[model samples]
Target: MTDAPALFLGQSDQPETLLLSRANRHGVVAGATGTGKTVTLQIMAQGFSEAGVPVFCADVKGDLSGICMPGSPNEKLLARAQEMGLALTPKAAPTVFWDLYGQKGHPIHTTVSEVGPVLLARMLNLNEVQEGVLSVVFHVADKEGLLLLDLDDLRSMLAYVGENAERIGREVGNVAPTSIAAIQRSILQLEQQGGAAFFGEPALRLEDMLRTSLDGRGQVNVLDATRLMNSPRLYAAFLLWLLSELFEQLPEVGDPDRPRLVFFFDEAHLLFTDAPDALREKVEQVVRLIRSKGVGVYFVTQNPADIPDSVLAQLGNRIQHALRAYTPSEQKGLKAASQSFRPNPAFDTAEAIQGLGVGEALVSTLDEKGAPRVVGRTKIRPPDSRLGPATDAERAQIMAASPVRGLYDTPVDRESAEEVLAARRGEADQAAADAKLAEARARADAAAAKEAEKAAAAREKEQVRLDREAERARAPARRSNRQTPVEALTKSVLRTAGSTLTRELLRGVLGGLKRR
Candidate 1:
């Protein structure tokens, strides 16, 4: 096998033997902060890009933007590449930038309704009841044709349904009020943490993510997520959603010579914080199964323990950076990271990590013919791409030139949960108003009936009085100067069995005109 220009974290003595063609196999990169983790990630992405395989990686510190431009020729960079026997090519790989915020890169968006309940429940850390209620929200959204675009839509729908829980719950099987409230609370928390910004229409397309430039160079897609690292929960939820989407959307291509795209998940530990056992198992399952689809997942973290052992096992190519063993736990972590690799006989693998300099790491990758290359104290090569972030102008230019630039730029509302729940609220308000109107009508009818009875009794009493008066005075005393309108109304209401306020209220409700 020929020694092709290497694009990886560390140098290799065997050069061509390690093929890493097993699309079934993946890789991992472990290193402490500032220990050149980003640079190492860049190397792998560059390597895969050169291999004509597009790479997907998160730009946690905003540095992966450098892939958009070729790296400058520095004295140190040239020396290192020369030392590694790599004829330095002053050329950058084709690349694209993506962001959930739509700020630094093209917007990568997805709808909450599409995410569904199972994954979302895991996201919110919802209990069984809360999960069930969440499902109800999804069901309602689907039945009503409401798209759960963003967090607000789902949050509003949850509240709207909760307001009419007694009625809607009864109709929709068993939607517990308690669970709805709990899910609502979780939604609020997610909103406050900025999860609302992720969902909407014109969602990210997996096909777009897997595309290359017209020049046939795989586009290295970089995500700008500097602010997201602060919100661990949101970060984890978003990452999991991305992976699940890839699995669900991408076709089963079986094993190709190389992965169509590779995903480098930085800050991998956040992915498991408070995750339920079942969801964690599901993640492991996705990681294991996605390889057959020709997608490689590389997790970058500070320690091996950050990854679940089940997930740790699926990583085939391993790149370990230097770790500080000042504390007992740190020392233990170093040993574990070292033991994870199939040892290279040339160097003491355990000590190599502490002794490794910045821009250097211990690499173990598949050989050219697709075998595990002999581990060596390999010198890492400088990236042919920029060592740092692309300039603002560069990002803007690339974004403008991006095929997906205008695709997700404008957010779409699409008659989703927000619209559905808004309509439902309008219905409820109308229903309440109608009920009030009916009640008023009933009172007016009753008042008219009572008025009829009172008028008859008064007429009868007058006849009796007149008859007696006629007997005494040979003529009935004529009743003149009839009672005033106010007095007449009071006298009529007093003859009824109802209270005065009720009669007055009824009169007001009937607008002083009882139906005859």
Candidate 2:
């Protein structure tokens, strides 16, 4: 057991240590405020980094930033290390600072698509119905190939789904406008709480956080969550998102010699506080199954009861600092916490929990065969890094020299749901306008055809009038233009009678002339 891989935690009756072989089994660091939980976390982080295991943790109080700076250990710290039979080195771990707002260090970003609907619904605090609607929205986005990169993309997508709810609902499921509006309001609230900066392009790449120094020291990725604590849900959701990312992106190694990465979830209660049952189950499931991926998750909270029993059962290694039990509820919690550990039989575990001084904890970790060792009253080791936040100038210098210095610092606005939906709407509008113009042209054509018909009819009528006047001009003038057959015969007989009378008169006149 002497040469076995392990992290020296501190001195108990014997040397207290956490076997690195079982580090992937997951653990917890629980204590009240100012009970050396941060220090314990720092020591564990440094230990893992030294083992070439990358670490990710939130800087809630801004104190974890000191891991990037060398410590100025006081005499007391040095004496404690010597008493523990160890020579201490005050050197900083290789650390890279991160911030969601992009003010502290490298900006940590993730697409809305990556956040997905479930975690997003939890983040937005949506009810069941609203969450279902959100799931439908995600489905539609996926089907339509819309990339939801940021808040605007999500907002526009919601509007699109809301406007086309019936059609979309028939294809998928019911997307209530009220539910959509509620989710929208929740998004607005999240945006107001500064969540807009988190969902965008140039998202955080897991490889960057999982990097190790060229010298084989693990890189410590510290997220500046001091201001983020103002919105506890955001802080919790982000860390959980990172954990989920690690679980999904990393292949299952099935209990590697050491964890590929170590995640320290600070202020863990916010993850479960008012969280829905489904969400809690999701968190529990992730914690349970993510160990096979060789990533260790350590929850840092004020009390063990803050974690649901289902989740609490999964944490094997426990470093519980002192917890006060002034109230009955507190005492009940204390009893429950103490009973969770294997009884040492040296002293009452419950009594030892309350009587423990600062930097003192009941250390229990899994043995080489993956079994919880008996609890030990132990003095936790001091961190080799500084005990407080790093100076602003020092942080700036580190960030300037960061490996991912320029990668995620600037924001990227590529084409996504926002622009896609907008262009679709614009096209729709142009189509409508063209249709109206076509209808107007059709009406105009009909009017022009009717006018042409009327003009043709008038011209035909005028031509008929002109033909009648030409017929009058070509005809001979007579009082009666019609002829009768009886009148024509009577006129012929009169002409014959008159010719006979003339012939008789001419004969009588010729006879008288001859007699004379």
Q: Count the backbone clashes (under 3 Å) in each candidate.
A: 15, 0
Residues 396-471, candidate 1, lDDT per residue (tens digit)? Answer: 9888888776888898777766776778779988999999999999899899989989999999999999999878
In candidate 2, stretches whose alpha carbon ends up further than 4 angstroms from where it belongs are 456-516
Please give, for residues 1-516, the per-residue lDDT of candidate 2 as tens digits: 456789999989988899888998899899889989999999999999999999999889998899999888899999999899778888999999999999998888999999989889888988889989999989999999999999999999999999999999898887788998898999999999999999998988999999999999999999999889988888888888888898889998998999999999999999999998988988998999999999999999989999999999999999999999999999988998998899998999999999989999999999988989999999988888999989999999999889888999888999999999999999999999999999999999999999999999999999999999999999998789556898878878888889999999999999899999
lDDT of 2 at 159: 98
Query: lDDT, candidate 2, residue 279?
Result: 80
For model 2, the local distance difference test gives 0.92
TM-score, every prediction: 0.81, 0.89
